[model samples]
Target: MISDHILLTLQVLPILPTLAATNLRQRISAFIHERTYQAPPDGHVKNVIVIGGSFGGYQAVKRLTKTLPTGYRVVLVEKNSHLNYVFAFPRFIVVKGHEQNAFIPYSGISKGALEGIFHHIQDTAMEVTERFVELKSGARLEYEYLVIATGSSSKLPSKVSSTESKYAQQELRGMQDKIRQAGRIAIVGGGAVGVQLVSDIKDFYPEKEVTLIHSRAQLLHSFGPRLRDLITETLTGMGVTLRLNARPDLSSETNTLKFWNGDEEMYDLIIPCTGQQPNSNIISTVSPASISKETSHILVKPTLQVMDDRYPYIFAFGDVAATGGPRMGRAAMFQADIVVDNIQQLIAGSRNLCVYKPKFWFEGAIKLTLGKNRVALYIQQENGQEILVDSNLGHEDGDVKSQWAFFGADAEELETRKI
Candidate 1:
């Protein structure tokens, strides 16, 4: 009997060559356009406005500005002035002195050839219409095409709730101080965030009593059993207690928690690590039919455009789009590439557009930190085997330097917070 993993590998293996060629062609085309494309008169420009300047929206802006032809400019409407390094949030809240590194400045986003083709507005989108978007400051932006990449929202530790980097740093420092002072810490929700955070706390302060409370018997149930078992064993070995299959009564006092089975425990700190909602209010406000009734995510076609035929010019991706895959940064980037190509095709008067197919297994891979200096990269082999590649090499500052370089910024800029 062939396992599901093996079958998935077999299915994807046959198409690897095609996928590689397609990706190569995209790169070649983008390179050619980047060097030779010329912009038309400043007065005769059409806008391709993209909302939310995180993973998907940022990538879309980068690609569109490089590949789109003359007379088209990309207007990036982002609420935050900087890109929130969300992947580093779990570690930032636990570690000390590196919280500011989690926010990367956006000033350098339009350097080099991207200068004239890009314009960024640091404001929130209050409402969306078929033709334009209304901002919180009462300004309206008319767009020939729109990309909704508003992503999702979650509480601190799992995500940075503040738009301001200063406030976000303070919040993370506060959490770090709380973790430092508290002898007994209770972390609710044993998902990825909870697991990673609790492990960091325990790994950092071995003497502290860290308890992970989860509603399910397994950690990361979306992944395979081997990874789950490995995490369970690793956490248990680090002296972290696991309380499974129960939820805490939220009505209890700030320092006291009561479980469903009448179990009660007193703690100095209790952190809730669950609850994430899609930031699809702007789209839902005007086009209610475009939102999924069950998930509240925006309904998007395989081509990454809004499902509503009336608004073919509007597209949504990332967490806000119901892409039938794991909500991941990698998936968002992949979706953005396809959206960029489709938008370019539409701009060039071509009906042939690329569709976004979720690369489930590849995008689902996670490099989870077990401790400050230990990490595990989880991968699924071609023969249905889920393997965990454990490593001792890990970064205390969440390896933010690599991300700084990825954004084409100097490490010195990150140090000065000037980018």
Candidate 2:
């Protein structure tokens, strides 16, 4: 009972490990090295603190460590114990036996970036001041420059538990149990997460009744119309009940949902696959004018620096910045390139500053796994058309290897062995 008039904008969007050292002296030397190294007493070294260890923050810290001049220490502050590789969350959360691989150890990143140049702190940021970030642990990390990349949060299972690593694992396992127990599942918000969850759940338990309710007429409203049609077809073909242009009543009970269309449904479980909301409170407090009330993003220039001229040195990106593009992981990585380059130019006393140009379209490339075997990819074509390709990666494809094999992936692990 959805109308075609609500066809509007939707942006589709888009995920480490450790290793052993070669020698004993090198191992000892590296073991003693600090991940979040401090400057010398004489203040010869500059502190480059990057908050958030997700895709963008990790990339920023990695770039700083490899490119920054010597004596400039890179510090990454992440509250989580491990970098949860969420790319496979849609699949891994549904299918069993993949939970162990979902989380990559935060230890042993930046194979050759430099000894003692990069440091990691397992803590959360409570506020941002002009000179430094105040941590929840009552520690102040002073920085010559700061990068905010605290990405948004979503429902658990789709997102790992927000607590510590062990608890996160337990939470994921708990969701697995719930998925197994629930005969009827309702997923709210038909973005990438909701659609993908429908496919994943159907693949895992084909007999279960799974329903996806989207508020927009088009599932991925920002994506090209072609992709939206394809998603609708695939979801229905795979046995998911699709409800378009429907909003759930907030006052409904825990297990029941009443829709805006005057329809009500009862399910054993309901999961909200929400989109990213900027974690901009800390920086917004410091420079209120730098944030936009509309999008909850810290207003930044194209160079990714805060709009407030008084604090141009502070930069924001990823889900936290109003960057005028789809907030994709790759987009954040691209922003890191510009931020790091500009920081380099600033420290080198060079007038040339690199402006950031997003590589992906405003919505980024559309990637969704319809089922264990069916994968769909959407690339933008010229004149506003979209090239849609569907492939079957299959449940047992060899190409899907653990991504931690390469260095500088996942922005270097939080912990690394010395040497």
Task: Give the Cα error of residue 56 in candidate 2, in Å.
Answer: 1.1
Cα lDDT, all candidates: 0.85, 0.74
Model 1 lDDT per residue over 148-181, tens place: 9998888878776677888878889988899999
lDDT of 2 by residue, 1-419 (tens): 33222212222222001113223443454444444434354457778889998878877876676666557888899988877777777666676655555566555455565766778899999999989899999999889989989888666645775647667766777777888899999988888888887888987699999999888888988788878899898888889999888889745557989877677888999888866667889886689998897877888898889899998678888888988666788788778878887887888788688777665543387667888788777767335756666778655321224455432334233223111
Model 2 lDDT at residue 310: 94
Q: Positional deviation of 317 in candidate 2, in angstroms?
A: 0.8
* Every model's TM-score: 0.92, 0.85
Clashes of each: 0, 17
lDDT of 1 at 388: 64
